[model samples]
Target: MTGESGTTRLPRQRDTTPTAQVRLLVAVGTDKHPFDRLVDWLAQWHAQAADPVRLTVQHGHTPAPGVPGGVPFLGHDALQQAMADADLVVCHGGPATILEARRHGHLPIVVPRDPARGEHVDDHQQLFARRLGAAGLVALCETREALHHALATGLADLSRYAVAADPHAHEARRAAVDRVGQIVEELVDRATRRPPRWRAWARPDRGAKETR
Candidate 1:
């Protein structure tokens, strides 16, 4: 859009399909670290309740909760396909997983790994999940109660997190790409044109050849 001051703005667009169309996919991650807390919580839920949603779980490094048909891990391709078919995704707070869920049109219900509980090396997962939650990108659940509540309520209205295509956002992305390209070009030029700092350290016997 052209602004009053003659500045052009990128148009933003969003389109959403109703949530009633997909199944459910759950994953923690393939990290070596076990997320038994999440796994156990899920297994307990599965065992106790008659969940109507068709659920497929990728338990990852954690021991299977012994859920009758549990899968230890779905390789990348299988996971992607599962996400594509899912209306809701229950997952750990890894940023890549969250983004992948969103790409598949599900606003993931995320339980971030807590390092205090030895779920991760640090609290980055919790921190990142909070940030995304604040942006209305993912539903954040810190405890089993919260996770259960989110799943119960969220599955019914998956459209709530459906991303709408916005032209403004698209334009901003293009602008960001252009800016990054410019910065990369500048860095490459500088690296190529700048004199080698090791020039002074060159062997005199070698005619002071510049070191790479």
Candidate 2:
């Protein structure tokens, strides 16, 4: 498939729809606060979404009571499975989640967690968001306001979020991987270092005792 830029796109894997109960899947949070606020936000967005009903926000973390829209949270395996069935994915900025969502061909909307705001342990998530968004595989929402808008409207085209896996950035990722592989193999092939004691004769007796 060719996109607007005339770049040939990779063949897309077809998504399998399950019982059709869910159309959107959300995998929020990091090592931080467990996506509670994100869940609350989604609930509000869902309440205003119309029928055909827009989407079912399959969450990855539990929401406190009276959160009107989203329901029970799914396990890791379950959420990935749900993404495979989903038409779209909403998530925090995590590479693993972005990879899975792309593998399943679900357009992803990523919201970066701000550590300055106490959203995560650090700012790596912001980096993740920037890279993926720049690549074209996912749409990045830098704030709760942006996230709500992204979800309410549906998956944003942001193909610019992922590079064409067939080529474009292929050489870059592969070269990096190959370099690491070589380094690892070189390390593995190195001779083991012996302790100073081992360098000494295993048996002082191995050497014929110098006749006094």
Q: Pick the candidate with the highest TM-score.
A: 1
Q: What is the C-alpha lDDT of each candidate?
A: 0.69, 0.58
Off by over 4 Å in 1: 1-22, 165-212
Q: Tell me the tens digit of each residue's lDDT in model 2 across 50-169.
A: 533334454444445244335455667767567655666777776666666665565578886677666666666676567657866578887668877776565333232333333344
Report the C-alpha displacement of residue 165, candidate 2, in angstroms.
Answer: 10
Q: List runs of model 2 lying over 4 Å from the truth.
A: 1-22, 29-32, 52-62, 65-73, 155-212
Please state the error at residue 122 of candidate 1 in Å. Answer: 1.1
Give candidate 1's whole-model lDDT: 0.69
Error of 2 at 208 (Å): 54
Give RMSD to native, each candidate.
Answer: 10.1, 11.5
